[model samples]
Target: MSNSNLNSSSNHFSCPKGGAGYVCPDEPQFVGCCSQDPCRNVDANSTSPCPGSNLYYASYDPFIHEEIPANACIDGGKWFTCTGANPSFIGCCASDPCKSPDHTGCPDDDLLPAAWSKSRPGQFALFQDEGTADDDELSGGAIAGIVVGAVAALVTIGALVWFFVRRRGNKAAAMSGHRHTSSVIEGEHRRMYPCPASPSFISSWIGAI
Candidate 1:
């Protein structure tokens, strides 16, 4: 078959009326809405008829591939023709073979399109791995900080002990010195109380007596 014929299969291949031979680009290839046939001759049907057909066959711009609109295919074999001029339909069909315009009986969101959840299974494990390393680092820092603080406290306690000891020693020395001075003064006063007679006075008194 020619490349055109091969590519044509990508479009609607059969007629909309469930006929085996007739082919139209505007008509859905499948006999019923659920038919697996592709749309044909999208180049000829620039203006789409059959607005109610759920299936659409159109060539995409830039890639030149045929596409089917999502939820655009119907049971009557007529492709739902989009009157809206937006070329989004073209891109949608070109990318996905099983495009459905209507989300009926379909998932609210396409799991294939939202692929970020695939990595979710291991996310908690990854976070824990990183957190474990961080925790080790934090524990080491805390231990070091505690050691330094304890050493500083010990030094402070030692200094305070030395200060108190030195103060007591000085106080004891001062009290001892004061007591010695008071004893010496009291001894001198007792000697001064007994007055001594002169030698001449003693001789004269002896003679007179």
Candidate 2:
């Protein structure tokens, strides 16, 4: 190849199919010579890079009928595409978290895209609210309450039993005291009654003597 042709070839941007090129910050792939308009110069039918070769076209438009847009070629992170309408920003340029670095196809997020703003925030919020140790703490408190309640119930039962036993003992003592009082009354009556009647008769006889 001539030096001029070599220079021209060197100036041209060559990348593997579905491969990414040098990306300038805040610049879309369509802004430079690799834009959709420039790719039209190359034929879309051939796979080899020769003069009048459709390899450029084949590279530009892999599926013959549809032309791959310049913006689609730019690496817009892993899952997202940087379109002309919604160009990728610096913050959005990182590798996809869900896909491996070797992966070339669209990310799973893109194939089955989530409602990013709605689903992620809500999921994280729910995790924040319900994913703590509070449940375990609450269960511990409940167990403590049950244990205290059981102890209190046992103490109450013991006190009731003691009170009933003391009451029965007091009743038995009162019955014994009543029986002793009746016996003392019968003994006093036996000692005084006959003495009274005999003393009266004897006093009369002694006065006659």
Candidate 3:
């Protein structure tokens, strides 16, 4: 029942001999192969036993050999453990939408574990960090989208700033040019008629504009 090798790279197991390898059966007594899973034989409550029961596997056990596809652990989002009515003979789950947490030892993607009843119930179980695994599931597309959005926002902001600055500079340059033109005209008029043009001439030229 030692779950020491649970969820590791290899699925090697160390099953005990005879009646000492089953968990939660009608009795602690179990003999022969580790076929009778304890997840189904656990303490039942209410009218139906396997309708919505959650499956939980022992991280470590002294007398059980946990099977990945066994109906002994509660890890799926929809069904914790398959009832006799909806027994998962072919597969444990169809598709995983409800992602598994970091400590659950599930894949980074939304897929559920291939099997159930992992890690027998006997040895000291090593639980994963209770942190969330959603970050691990971020796809390349999602990350790229975020990066593109950020860059586009920055470029837009820069363009707007440059437009305003260029517009302001143009206005200032125009104003200076107008002032210079006016000064040159006045100076030229004074030099052309040092005695000052006749009131009629002044009125005809400067007053015209």
Model 1: lDDT of residue 27: 35
lDDT by residue for model 1 over 1-209, one digit each (tens)?
Answer: 00122123343222222212212223332121212223342235433212223333332222212122222322222222233323322211222323445422112121111000112232111112222112223434456899999999999999999999999999999999999999999999878786788899999999999
**Could you tell me which 10 consecutive residues in candidate 2 have the lowest summed lDDT?**
52-61
What TM-score goes with each of the models? 0.30, 0.30, 0.33
Report the number of clashing residue pairs per model. Answer: 23, 0, 19
Q: What is the lDDT of residue 103 in candidate 2?
A: 37
The residue-by-residue lDDT of candidate 2 on 45-73, one tens digit each, is 52211211111111111111111111223
Error of 2 at 38 (Å): 44
In the range 1-209, model 3's lDDT, one tens digit per residue, is 32223233232222222111222222222111123343354354422112222222213221122212233323343222221211111113333322333234222232222222233332112122111113244335566899999999999999999999999999999999999999999999988878845788878887679
Candidates' lDDT values, in order? 0.34, 0.32, 0.35
The better-scoring model by TM-score among 2 and 3 is 3
Q: Predictions ranked by lDDT, top down?
A: 3, 1, 2
How many clashing pairs does model 1 include?
23
The better candidate by TM-score, 1 or 3, is 3
Angstrom error at residue 45, model 2: 34
RMSD of each: 24.4, 23.1, 16.7
Best by TM-score: 3
